[model samples]
Target chain A: MIIQREAVLLFAGLAVVLAVATAIGWTLKRFLAEGAPHPTIDNLNARINAWWVMVVVIGLGAALGRTALVVLFALVSFFALREFLTLAPTRRGDHLALSFAFFFVLPVQYYLVAIEWYGLFAIFVPVYVFLALPILAALRSDITRFLERTAVVQWGVMISVYCISHVPALLMLQIPRYEGRSLLLVLFLLAVVQASDVLQYVCGKLFGRRKVAPQLSPSKTLAGLVGGAASAIALGAALGRLTPFGVVGAAGIAAVIVAMGFLGGLVMSAIKRDLGVKDWGAMIEGHGGMLDRLDSVCFAAPVFFHLTRYFYT
Target chain B: MRLLPQLLGKAVTGLMRLLTGAQARWVGCGPAPTQRIYFANHTSHGDFVLIWTCLPPSLRAMTRPVAGADYWLAGGLRRYLITNVLNGVLIDRDKATRTRDPIEVILAALGEGWSLIVFPEGTRNVGAELLPFRSGIYHVARQRPEVELVPVWIDNLNRVLPKGDVLPVPLLCSATFGTPTRLREGEGKDAFLARLCRAILALRPA
Candidate 1:
């Protein structure tokens, strides 16, 4: 009974999001017909199209139950980690460490989450993989930039795999009353984070004047941050029944996610600047790559997971 | 039987893309079915495979990698891959006297309307720097003057799978194909080789 109710809710929610996206896309198309189409508008349309596909995939995964959902997110983690490590400069000495990170560490991390092995999942990458990767590099005997190379690969695994895994790990939360509806928590987190991102982009395009960090991210603006966060907070409050958090609690948590999401984009932008690449990869049409789409989720996942685990569960 | 090689090609292609995240950029000229020599920098064992897999499927069928006879023919899986899967042109790199001219073998492959992928450095370098050309490229160009010589600069391959590494790290690599060059009349061997080297080097990402 609970599963049927959840499935209906998931589909209905997806339909609403899709309808809104189509309307926005239609309006943008009409607007684009009027003028010499702006690059930002084209990019906006592309992102909206990508969002429709993402929503369909997620909705389908949610309908299929836990295993599919976990597998879907695991694939996302794989792509995100691939994007992250591709840009970061790693030497030959780090090859074994990286092979292990991709082949061994990432899968193991996701497996732990799937099996609900919380203790190992939390520290596998951070503690064991982190120490082991440097030692692997050291074994190659290439001491030049040893510490820097090791740290970069370790950080990539931590952020892309370990942190992103927590998003799906929401499914395993053993809340007293929550029971089978834990997937709702995952949906709530994704909804708030992605909503914040989209709203921020829309706001920035319309009212952006003062850049937040010109050096790091020219697209980010103070106006967009405030307006987007406020809108997302309202949205989260409105959808509060979906999660264990009530209206006020949901709003507060949404604000935290928004702030972290903003910071996540900034930090990733900084890393891109350091690497001297505009986008992470060219996989997602106009959205850059998987990492670009998930930067916020990567940062917010662990925080939201821990918060929900502590407070609600 | 035919399906096996096709599946193997695709699997190898997928693996190369997954491991290196290789992006193929035809900067100067778009991919065409014309006979051409894709000369690139050799950095790892995976260099030829990376370049080979990056080609469009239509072009990939007609292209063969020029590999070292000593290494690719060492037997077992390497031999099977080079002979059956890739249809690679193996040349003796060490014994210039005992073996037939590697250039003749490549030229014969070219004569059959097949394109060839050659590493002008002749050997893989451990560092990022491009090693000096080994005269094989110049000789090929002189013989097949009409054949386009496309310079491909493969970046980050050294770091992905350097010398003596059995496994490859999943790193982003790119193969930038520059404007095709040909051997000029009255050009000295040294001068032509230098020019060819410069063309490949120019395609490196800033």
Candidate 2:
């Protein structure tokens, strides 16, 4: 009987979310059709389509069981890490460090979250993985590009493995009044973060009067950033019950995520720009790379994870 | 299970195309025939992928590659990928004593109406000059005189993705299909192998 009630709630929750997403997507679809950069607009639509598929898959997994959902997120982190390293300049000396980062650190980070080891989960990547990887790389003694290579591996490990894993770590939270509603929290975070990206693209196309960083990232605009971040905060507060937060608290958290997400996107864009490439890898047609999709999550995940743990836990 | 593997395949192929923009050309797909032995000079790891990705999907089904058994058969994942994903025929090249005949294995694959890709240089060369041809190509061709011996020249593969590198940087590579040649009656093994090597070298752009 409880399962049936949960099922009905989940279905209702999903229908509402999907309907809203579709409406927003439809609005953007119509808006893009009017007068947008043809290629980037097409790419944005394709990214939205891919998001729809990913959301459905994860949603179904969550409805099935918590473990399934955790495992799905784990696989996504693995792919994102793979995409990151595939582009990063690597050396033979970095192989062991890279392997350890992928096989050990990634699994352990998620396992910590899965078991609700909050404190260790929060610091594992930044503190431990960051220190250990360079030591392993330096052990090779082929110090040609030693500092640069170690930094590259360390950065990839942090951004791809350690940071992104926190999003799934959200599942282990035990929020009051939201027992077994962790999936909804996941949805809320994803919806706000992804909606921000989609809306930023929409606004950038519609009324991007001022450039945010003409040299750094030409696509980003100050107008788009403000508009998108505002909408995300508004949506975040509206879905505050999804977390252990009230409306005002939720807005505060969303504001943090928006700022962090912008920084994350900028930093990753700078990295790609330095590497002299457009996209990280072409896994998704419209989206640039795995890093491109996960850039916002890299920043948003850790902040959200820590905030929820600090107050709720 | 099947659907998952198919999706993985598509995802992997898509990833490859994404990293390296798809710049494939199918100008000369040569008519469907019973069997043909493709001999090409290998410069990089991209040689196999370039050739395999270039062939028609239908023809790829029956085509098998002669990969070094020591490397391809090293572990379960590699074995599964070579035999299942790529449908390769592994050959042991480091036997100190006489073992199972390699020619018989390749002949059997061709006899089953499967086309095979062979690297006559036997090993990857870091330089532009074609490595010395091995006797394996002559032996395989001598046994299957009926099969068309097509000499393929893969240019700029080494520059696209060098050997022993995990990441493949995007660069244009062209696989030139030279006119098919066959072993003449009473031709010596060294002469035939050299001619085959030269036929491939002839196709490289100046």
TM-score for each predicted model, relative to the true structure: 0.94, 0.71
The lDDT, on a scale of 0 to 1, for candidate 2 is: 0.74
lDDT by residue (A1-313, candidate 1, tens digit) is 7756865776687678768877877786677655467676677777778877888899888888899999998888888888888887777667888889988998899899889999998888888998899888898899998878988998899889988999899999998877888888888899899989988888887898999899999988888888898999998898787777888999999888888888988999999999998898887877998999999998998999999889987
Off by over 4 Å in 1: A1-38, B96-99
DockQ of 1: 0.66
RMSD (CA, Å), each prediction: 2.2, 7.5
Candidate 2 residue lDDT tens string, A219-288: 9998899898898899889777556688999899888888888888889889988887777766665786
Best by DockQ: 1
Q: What lDDT is reached at residue B20 by model 1?
A: 75
> Which 10 consecutive residues of model 2 chain A have the lowest summed lDDT?
A1-10
